[model samples]
Target: MRVAACLMTLCIPAVSLLAAGCPDTGASYDDFAARYDKINPGTTVASGPSQCETPLGSDMEATGNWLFTLSVKLNPKKAFVLSAAVTAEMQDDGSMLVDMSLQPLSATDQTTPVCGATIEFTDLPVAPDGSFAWVLAPNETPLSLCGEANPISMSEILTGLQIAGTICGPADAPFACGTVTGIVEAPLPDFDLTGSSFTMQKALTDGSFPPPVLNCERAPADF
Candidate 1:
């Protein structure tokens, strides 16, 4: 599993959300991953170039790319912009699904060390209005997405606004990657949120900074 470990102390107000029950109670997280495999089929990402092929935002306006100015405050002094090329499809069950392969982009204009690292979020549901949340796998099976011991769990509180609609927060959800230090128990709501009516300009969450430069061409071919 490729992991992007974010070390930050985030304290989001936890709030309860209504449940979106699973179709089967016996199903496991593995079951969900299998469903995702059916959707994405098979894929392998080739290592990306040391430098991105182009400045990140140049092609954002082009069709098929989803350019979003995000609200992510890493701290009172620093924040990060969120941008990615999104692919969505209708699942057999009628739920709309999405995939976004993550790359490290620089908001500071100065190149950041995270250029070629990869973090992929696969098969999340997409709402009609574009708001979406990862409701987590069923409680019956406790295994990390990477097949390790389950590191964290999502609560109804997290399923509320914190997990909703592309806001970069997941109150109680740790990443699919195994244990991320300092965040093993309660990973920094550390998600790169997505989905908002295709807006390119939005309020700067922490300060003025460009979104990280992404290499969408390097995104996994199957995704």
Candidate 2:
């Protein structure tokens, strides 16, 4: 399982602003555009390259057992929680080396299981204050979409996935990524997180680390 990790101590009072301009998931192209226009009001996706904003906003204590709750716009009822263990060490180079271990806290929504498989950080550069920012922009290779049930075997599902639309972010910084648009298949687009965010809080009551849960139903044996 491949997991993307983020290390930051952010407190976002303006979380609603984070959802603005992100691509719409689980909606048709026309609907996506309409909603995008409604939120942005006269802006265009093709306007230019937008920076991929980090969900990390303000600040909090860095090292702790955190309950990471990822909220997606598509399914508000679904749960996306991960147990995160963060360790920060001061490096000789005057930067902090941060590492995080993240695992599913329970049965998650279809998207969270695969996307939240692992969170790794090795010698990541950080500020003097131990805060960092990062965004997992879409890579050149499209990712395999997973679910609770596979139409066939997980391997088949992975190999057969078609390329879908791009997920965009903020604008005008090395922290962001360039934008691209494309047509996607039906049943809403895959890997869409338009107006979604990962919010984390210290698990004050749960001192024990979160245990790993079972893999998605019909998942590949190795997975």
lDDT of 2 by residue, 38-136 (tens): 544444432311222332222223455655544334443343455667665655654455566655443333223443345343343344432233222
> In model 2, which range of ten residues has the least summed lDDT?
156-165
Per-model TM-score versus the true fold: 0.33, 0.40
Off by over 4 Å in 2: 1-61, 91-95, 108-117, 124-131, 141-191, 205-223
lDDT of 2 at 37: 48
Global Cα lDDT for candidate 2: 0.33
Candidate 1: regions farther than 4 A off: 1-63, 68-77, 91-95, 110-115, 135-162, 166-223
Error of 1 at 217 (Å): 31
Q: Estimate, for each residue in 1-223, the C-alpha lDDT of model 1 and write its tens digit.
A: 1111111111122221112222232233234334333333342111111122222221121213333322222221222223444555654543356555433334443223233333344565533322243322232211121111111222111211112222211222101100000111123343322221112222233433333222211111110
Query: Could you report the Cα RMSD, in angstroms, for every candidate shown?
Result: 17.0, 14.9
> Clashing residue pairs, candidate 2?
10-58, 11-58, 50-170, 51-170, 51-171, 52-176
Top lDDT prediction, candidate number: 2
Count of backbone collisions within predicted model 1: 5
